[model samples]
Target: MSTNARQQLQHHLRNARYEVLPLRGTLEQVQGLPPGTTVTVTSSPSKGTEATLDLAARLRGSGMHVVPHLAARLVRDSAHLDELLSRIEALGLTEVFVIAGDADNPAGRFTDALSLLRGMEEIGNRPHRVGITGYPEPHSFISDQMTIQATDEKARYADYIVSQICYDPNTIASWVKTMRARGVTLPVYIGAPGSIDPSKLLRISMKIGLGQSMRFLRKQHGVVGKLLTRYTPENLFDELSPYLVNPDYNIAGCHLFTFNEIAKTRQWAMETADRLQEVPA
Candidate 1:
């Protein structure tokens, strides 16, 4: 790798944020993160919004910058938004990620991220930084045009974006180019899975409807089998170095989906950082 590219890789890795689901062993895994590391909690249909908030509160108490996922579909109303903001502030959190969520039906008025974002702005207790999601591939339910429009609208309220998991760097690069052309200039944190067992990875992928990406990987035979053995983010990160280093992309850093395997991910990141440092600049 070129010295400039290597250095950019190090910079992006050092600033990467980690996202974790609220489940058993989450606290212990979170406790393993470096002090002041940014940890975003994911909201689940089974666990609900309260669980996400509780996990964020606990993580904040442990000294991490906790950004809880605020699922718009899960929120009850404007007053509910106010209460959620109050709870997050009381925990000293000033960042949040908004998603449309996976709920089969809306629990309240807000059904999408744009509505929730606008509602938050209207309430006057906005977080210091707000994040919204981006999809490089076409969404299963929403049209490509709708996704673009929603992102453009949400960008008004958001400070940055975390893209959904995409296996192809070429696709990601193209998506970034298109986004820049459309004038959505928020800094993007590319989403990638952390170290995870292959079976678990496959199950998670299936659960989230990432069938196309999974099928592509499966055809590569070795990649899918190796994922079962031990899957790391090395190859993906290396492929992304060009986009990260190039000034035009505005690819801020990584947003790792750790899958609660915090210790392994932490080790991998540290080791990779060390490797990057050794590359002569």
Candidate 2:
């Protein structure tokens, strides 16, 4: 790696945010993370926003910077949104990541992230920092044009963009270039899988509509085999290092999808950061 790339990689690794699902054992794993670590709690249809908020509150109490996912479709209506925002404010949290969500049907008038964002604006209690999703690779259901248009629209209300977990660094780099060309200036946090078990990672990827990215991984020689054995973000991080170092990309840092493997993810991040900082023999 170039000197700049190495330095940038270490810097991002040091400040990376961890995305964790609000499931059983998540609290304990998050509690084990280094103090003041930024953790984004995910909301799912089954768990509902309550689960995400509950986890975010607990994590915040544990002294971590918590960013909870507010799945638009799961939110009922204006009253519900107000209640959620109130709870968030009560916890002294000021960051949230919004998504259209995976629900087959909307539970309220806010069917998408854009609408939810508008609602927040109307309510006038918006979080200090709002993050929206970006897809480097094509979304499973949304067309490329639509995704691009959606992102451009969402950019107006968002503080930054966090891309979906994509394994291919080239695609991510190209996507960043495209976004810049389109005049979307928000700094982007590249999403990547943490040091997760191969089997579990694959399972979760499919469950969360990452099939296209997984298919891209399968095309890479030996990647499928590696996925069956062990998976790490080192290769992906290295490949994207040059772009991460470039100011034109406006890359913020990494958003590691830890999938609740907090300990392993933390170890990998620390080790990689240290390795990059070490002087060569």
The TM-score leader among the candidates is 2
lDDT of 2 at 80: 91
lDDT of 1 by residue, 1-281 (tens): 77877888787778779999899889988888877999999997899999999989889989999999999999999999999999888889999999999999998999999999999989999989999999887777888799888888899899999989877677788889999998989999999988876788877776666645666567655566665465568777888787887878998888888888878777888889899998666
Q: How far is candidate 2 from the true structure (C-alpha RMSD, Å)?
A: 1.6
Candidate 2 clash pair list: none
Which portions of model 1 miss their true places by more than 4 Å? 215-230
Error of 1 at 38 (Å): 0.2
Candidate 2, superposed: residue stretches over 4 Å from native: 209-212, 222-230
What is the alpha-carbon lDDT of model 2 when measured against the actual structure?
A: 0.90
The digit string of per-residue lDDT tens for model 2 on 1-281 reads 89888888898999899999999999998877777889999998999999999999899989999999999999899999999998999999999999998899999999999999999999998989999999998887888899999999999999999999887788899999999999999999989989988888777777667765677778875576476465679899899988987888999999999888888998999999999889463
Local accuracy by lDDT, each model: 0.86, 0.90
